[model samples]
Target: MNKEGLYRDLSTVKQQIGLAKQFLESLNSVKFDRKNVLSWFKKLCGYLTDIILTILEIRSILENHVLNKKTMLLYLYQINTTLSLYINTFVAECEIGEALNEVRIFTTKKLSSCLDGIEDVLIKGISTYPENVGNFILWMDTALEKMSEIDHLKEKEKCLKAFSDAKILFEEVLSHAMSIAQVSMSEDYKIIRGSSQSVLEGLESLSNEISKENPNSAMVKLFAETCSNKLCALERKVNVAVLKICLSTFAKYTDDLENIHKFCFNTENKSKPRDLDNLVMEFDLHVDRIMQIGLFAISCSTNMATCIKIRSCLASLEALESELVPAFNAVLLDYCKQNCNLASILKNHWLNEAVLLKRLICEIIDPLAFCQIVHEENKYLVHTLSLDVKANKSKIDRSVTEQVIRNSIVLDDFLKLITYEEDNIIHIKENISFLQKIIREVKAASDVFLPQEQPELNFKVYKRCKILLNGIYSLCKNFLVENSENSFSKEESLGNEQPVVTGNGFLDHIINRGKQILQDRSILYRSNKIEAFDLRSTTLSKMNALKEKNKSIPLSKLVHLRKISFVQSPTRNQISCELQITDIVNELRNMSLTFEKC
Candidate 1:
C-alpha cells in the first residue's frame, strides 16, 4: 500500500482509539444494577473490540516501509499503554452485580488476554522497524521500569478507599451514639460512650497502620472487620437506648392521659358548661403534651408513615384548636340567639360533637397508653384512626354539612345583630369579632378538608367587612379622643361617634392616630400633578414626536427614557430690562466706533 493509504488507515486507527477512550471514560460513570448490567458488559466488549481493531490496523500499517516507522510506532505505542491503563483502572474500581458473576468472570478473562495480545503484537512489530530498533527497545524498557510504580500507586489507592469507607462507618456510629448520649447520659449510656471512644481510638490506630510503607492486607482486613463489628455494636446500643427512653416517656404520659380520660369522660358528675370548659382546657393542655411526646417519638421513629401521620394528626389538632373551636363557639352564640338558651345550645350542638372528637383523640392516645407494646404491633394507632374516621365519615360529614348549612342562617343573624345594634359600638365590635371567627373557621375548614372544592370568600364581602370594622374603630377613636366636651361635634355627629372612654394615654394616642389617618382628606388630592403623567404616556409622546420629525424612522430606533423626565427652570427671567453697567458701557463703545468708521 502507498504512504497516503497507510496514513489514511493510521488516521482511522487514531479515531477508533479516541472512541475507545471515550467509551472507557463512560465506563467510569456506569452504575451497575440488574437492569443495566448486561448493557454495561456490552459496552465493555465494544471498547475491547475497538482496541483490538485499532491495534490490528496499526500493525498492518507498520508493515509498509513508506511511512516513517519509528515515529508512527511511538504514537501507536501510546494508544496501547494509555488505553490499557484506563481500562485496568476502571475494571479495578468497578463493582459488578453478583448475579452476573459468571458472565463477568468469563468476559474479564477474555478482555485481559486480548489486551495482553494487543500489547505483545505492537511491541513485537516495533522491534522489526528499521534495522536498529533502539527507540522501541528503550520505550519497552521504560514501560517495564514504571510497572512497579503503577502497582504501588494502585495499592495505595485501594488502601485509601478502604480507610475512607471505614471512616464513614465510624462517623455514622459516633453520631448515633452521641444522639443517644444526648437523650440520656445515665450509667448505662456512659458504657455506650466508653465503647464508642474505644472504637474511635481503634479507628485512629488502623488509619496509622494503613499509612505504613508495606501494610499487611490481612491485618488491615481483620482490623476493618473488627471496626465494622464495633460500629454495629454501637448502633445496636444506640437503638436500644432510644427505645428505652421512648418507652419510659410514653409510660409516664400514659398515666396522665388515663387520668385525663377519667376526669373528662368517665366522671361521676353530670357534664355541665363549667365542666365542659374545664374539659376543653384540659384537652388542650394534654394535646400539647401528646404533641411534645409524639415529636420525640417521631424523631426516633424509623417508619416514614408513622412520622408523617403523627405530624399530620398534631397539625390537624392544632388547626382544630385555633380554627374550629372558635367557629364552634360562634355557632353556639348564634344558636343561643335563636333558642335563647345557652344550656340547650351546649347540650344539643356541643355535647355530642365534643364527645365524638374526644373519641377520636382517645384513639391516638389509647395506643400510646400501651407503652409496653412493640412499635410494629402498636403501629395500628394511625391505621385504626383512619379506619374509624372512614367508618364515621358519614357522621362527620353530616356534622360538617350541618355547620355549612348554618352559614345563611348565621349570616342572617349577623345582619340583624349589626342592623339592630349598629349604633352600639360594643355590640358592633362583638358582632364583627363573631363574624371574623365564622369566616376564619370556614376558611380554615376549607383549607384542611377540601381546598379545591370549597369556594373562597368573595372579595367584596371581605372588603365590606374590613370597611365596617374600620368605621367602628374610627367612631370609637373620634368619640374617645377628638370630640370636645367629649360631646358630638359636626364631624363627630356626622360620623355618629359612640361614647368611648379610653383611660390609657397610649391607647388614646394610637386611636387618635388611627382616626386621623382614616379621616385624612389629603389622600383625595394628588401631591404632585406632574407625577400623574406616568412613564408610559411620556415615552409614547416622545416616540410620536420622533416619528413625526422623521417618518422613515422606526419606533424601536428612538431613544428610550428609563424614567419620566420633569423639566424645571427659573420661574422669573434672569435677564434684566434695565441694562447692567458693563452692558451699557459696551453698547456706547460700539456706537462711537461705528459713527467714527462712517
Candidate 2:
C-alpha cells in the first residue's frame, strides 16, 4: 500500500479505538451486561495493538533506506506510545464504570422495593414505617447524585425516571399515612371509628413492624415520634371539646353586660333607677349561670391544655362581675350626680346655658354614648370625638359661611396688591406664601371633615383656596414673564452702542445691570416658595415651553427647578439669557470705531 493508504488505515483504527473507549466509559448500570461489554473492550484493545505493531513494521521498512528515517522512526514511536496510553486509560475507566454501575443497580433496586412496600401499607391504611421511609428518601437523594455523575445520558435518564417515580410514590404514602392519622383523631372520629377501627389496628401493626426492623434508623425514629405527637394532640383536642360547652353561656353573659352598659351610659335609653336595678338583677343571674357552667367545665377538664382554656374563660366572667359591672354602675352614679336636672335643662330651651347643653348633647354626649354601645376601643377615639364635634352640621355651616366671608375679604386685599405698573415679584411672593398657608389650612381641615357624612363644608373651603391660589400664581407668572421681556429689550438696546474694546465703559455698566436683573429673576424663579407658584396654569405653560426649547438638557439644569430639594439658583433660561447678554456686550465692545476729526 502507498503512504496515503497506510495513513487512512491508521486514522480508521484510531477512530475505532476512540469509539470503544467511549462505550466503556459511559456504562452507568450493571443491567447493561458488563461481562459482554468487557469482552468487547478487550477485543478492541487487542485489535488496536495489532494495528500499532503493523504501522511500526511499515515505518521500519521505510526508514531502512530513506534519508528521512529519523523522522519516520519518531512518528512510529509516537503512535505506539499514544496507543499504549489509550489502552491503559480505557482499562482503568472500564473498572470505575463497572463499580459505579453496580452501585447504581443496587441503589435503584433497594429504593424500588422500599417504595412498593410503602405503597402497600398506604393502600391498607396502615401506619407507615418512618425508619424505612426516611432511609428510602436518603437513598433516593444519593441515587440522584450518582445518576448525575453517570456519563451515559440515556441510562442516566432511565434510572433517574425510575428513582423519581419511586420518590413520588413514597411521598404519596407519607401523605396518606398523615391523612389517616388525622382522620382517626378528628372530632368526627367517634362516628368514623366503627368503620375505620380495623384500619387503625393495621396502622398500629405497621408501626410495630417498623420498630422491630429499623429501630436504628434516625429517620424512622423521627417519623414514629411525629405520629406519637399527633396522637397526643388529638387527645388534647377531645378533652378541650368537653370543656367548650360553657362558651355559649359565657357569650350570653357578655351580651347581658353589654345591655346593662348601654342602659347605664346610653342617653337615648329610659335610664330609670328601677330599670337599672332590674337590669343589674338580670345581669347577676346570667353571671351566676356562667359561674355554674365554668365550674362544671373546670371539673370535667382532664388535661392541662383543656384546663387552661376553661380557666381563661372563667376568669373573663369573673372580671366582668367584679370589675366591668361595678365600673358601669359607677359611671351611672356619676352621670346622675352631674346631670340630675338634665330633663329640666332639656325642657327649658330659652336659657342660654340650655343652648350649650344642647350642643354638648348633640355633639359630645350622643357620639360618646354611640361609641360605648358599639364597643369601639380605638386609641384615636378622643381625637375622633373632637373632630366629630367640630364637624357637626350646625357648626360646619356657621364656620363655612364665616370662612367664605373671611376668604373673600383676604382675597380682595391680595388683589389690591397686584398692579402692572412695576414688577410686583416681592408682593406676589408674599401673596403666594399667604395663599399656600390658606391652602394648607384648608387641606388640614378637609382631612377631618371630608370623611364625615357631610363633606360640603371642607370641600367648599378647599375649592375656594385652590381658586384663589391659582389666580395669584397666574398673576405672579405674568408679572415675571413681562419683566423678563423688558430686560431682554433693554439688553437689545444696549447692544447697538459704539465699541469700547478694553475698559468697563457705558455699555459694560448696562450689561452688568442686565446681568444683575437676570440673576435676581433667576433667584426668584428657583425659590422654594415658588414651587407652589409652579402649580399655576400659566407658570406650568411657560415651564413646558422652556422645557421644549432645551430638550437636550436636563429640566433641572435648564429650568433651575428643584425636583426633590428646594434651593434658589439660576434656571436654564436665565443662564441662556445671561450668556446672550454677555455675547452682545462682547460684540458691541469689539465693533470697529468710526471717528472724525472731532
Candidate 3:
C-alpha cells in the first residue's frame, strides 16, 4: 500500500478502536447481563484482531518509510496509552478491578516493552524486533481472553458494570502530536525564525538611522526593503500545517511594511505620526497574532530547542516593534521629524517600555506548565464527570437538573470573570466565595439521591465537587496573595482543605489499577524505581509531595486573553480536503468490512 492507503488504514483502525471504547463505556447504560458483557468482549476482541491484521499488512510498507515509521511508532504508543486508560476505566466501571490486577500488570509490561522497541526505533533509527510486535499481540489477545472470563464471572454474580453511554469522540490527538514531528521535519520554522530575526534587526537599524538628524535615504530604503523581503520569505515558507494558520497575517505584515516604506520614501508627503502610529499598531497586531499562533503551536510540543528558538525570535520581533513604534512616530511627526534630541528622548522611553513588555511576557504562563497543569486538570474533570455519571444510576429530578445547569452557567461566568478581571482582587474573591457556595449547594442536592453512607467517597460526584470547589478556593487565594497588600495566614492563604485520598474498596481498586499502569509506564520513562504498593498511602503521599512542590513552583500559568481567543476557523478548501479524506477512509473501511465478510 502507498502512504495514502496506509494513512487510511490507520484512520480506520483508530475509528474501530474508538468504537470499541464507546461500546465498553456504554456498559452502564445498557443492562449488564451475560449477553451484554459477552457482546462488549467480542466487539473489543474483533476490533483488536482487525487492528492487528492492519498492523501486519502495514509492517512491510512502514519499514520502507523510516520517518513515517517513527511517527507510526509514536502513534502506536499513544494508542497503547489510550487502551491502558480505557481498560482501567472498564475495570473500574465493572467493579472487577481485583480480577484485572494481574491483567493490568501484564498488559502494562507488554505495552512498556513495545514502548522500548518504539524508543529504540526513535533513538537508533532501527525497526523494532518482529518478536516485540508478535509478543505484544500474543499477550494482548490472551489479556482480552482473560478479561472476557472475568466479565463472564462478574455477570454470573449479577454485578452490573457501571459504564455509561458517551458520545463517540473523534481522537484528533494524533494530528496534534504529528504537527510537532511534521513541523520539525519540514524545518520551515528555521526559515521563518531566520527571516523574522533579520526583519527585526533591519527594522532596528532603519529606526536608528531614521533617528539621525540627517538620515541616509538610501540606507533607510535599503533597511526597509530588506525587512520586506525577509517577511516575504517568511510568508513563502507557510505551507506547513502549524505555519499555515499564520499565512494571511504574515502576508499582510509584509504588505504593511512595504506600504510604510512607500509612504516614507516613495510618496511626496509623509503621513502624520498619529496616522503612522495607527499603521504601526496594525502591523504590531499582525506580529502579535503570528507570535500567538507560534506560542499555541509550541505550547504542547516536546521539541524544547525548537520552542526556545521560536519564542526567542518572537520576543526579539516584539521588542523591535516596541522600539519601532516611537521611532516611526518620531520619524513621521513634522515637529520632531528632524529633531535628533526628541528622537533620543523617545528612544529611551521605547527602551524602558520594551523591557516592561518582555517582563509581561514572562508573567504569561510557562507553555510547558500550561500543558501539564491546565490540560491535565481538564482531562481529570472529564474523567471525573464520566465516572460520576457511570457510578450514579439514580436519576436527578428536573428541578435539580435545572438548578445545576443554572449554577453551571453562573460558575462559567464567574470563571470568566476571574480570568478577565484577574487584577480585581475584590471581584475575584467575591466570585470565588459564590463559586464555593454554589458547589456546596450542588453537592448537597446531589447527595439527596446518591448513597452517602459509603464514606469512601464512592459517589464520585461529591469528590469531584469537593475537588472543584477546593481548586477554585486555592486559585482565588493564590490570586489574592499574589495581588493583595495584606498578608494572609498560612491556613487561610492555602484556601479550603484539600480532599484526602482515603482508603476505600471501590476507590482503592480504581486508583490501584490506574496507578499500576502509570507506575509501569513511569518506570520505563524515568530513572526512579518508584512503586505503588499501598494505594491509599502512596496516593496521599504523592499528592502532598506534589502540593508542596507546587507551592514553590506555579502549577498553572496565566494565559493571555488573545491567545485563547484566537481560533483558526477552517477555510472552504480545508473543509473540502477534510471531507475528501474522510470519504477515502470510509471507502477503505468499507472494503475492509467486505473482506471481513468474505
For each candidate in turn, give its C-alpha RMSD to the true structure in angstroms.
42.9, 44.5, 31.2
lDDT of each: 0.36, 0.33, 0.38
Greater-TM-score candidate between 1 and 2 = 1
How much is 397 displaced in model 1, in angstroms? 54
Model 1 TM-score, all chains together: 0.24
- Per-prediction backbone clash count: 0, 4, 1
Name the candidate that leads on lDDT: 3
Once fitted onto the true fold, the runs of candidate 2 whose alpha carbons sit more than 4 angstroms away are: 1-253, 268-271, 336-598
Query: Model 3 — TM-score against the truth?
Result: 0.20
Worst 10 residues of 2 by lDDT: 557-566
- Better model by lDDT, 1 or 3? 3
Query: What is candidate 3's lDDT per residue for 458-483, written digit by digit as tens?
Result: 34444555455454445434443344
- Which segments of candidate 1 are over 4 A away from where they belong? 1-154, 254-304, 313-598
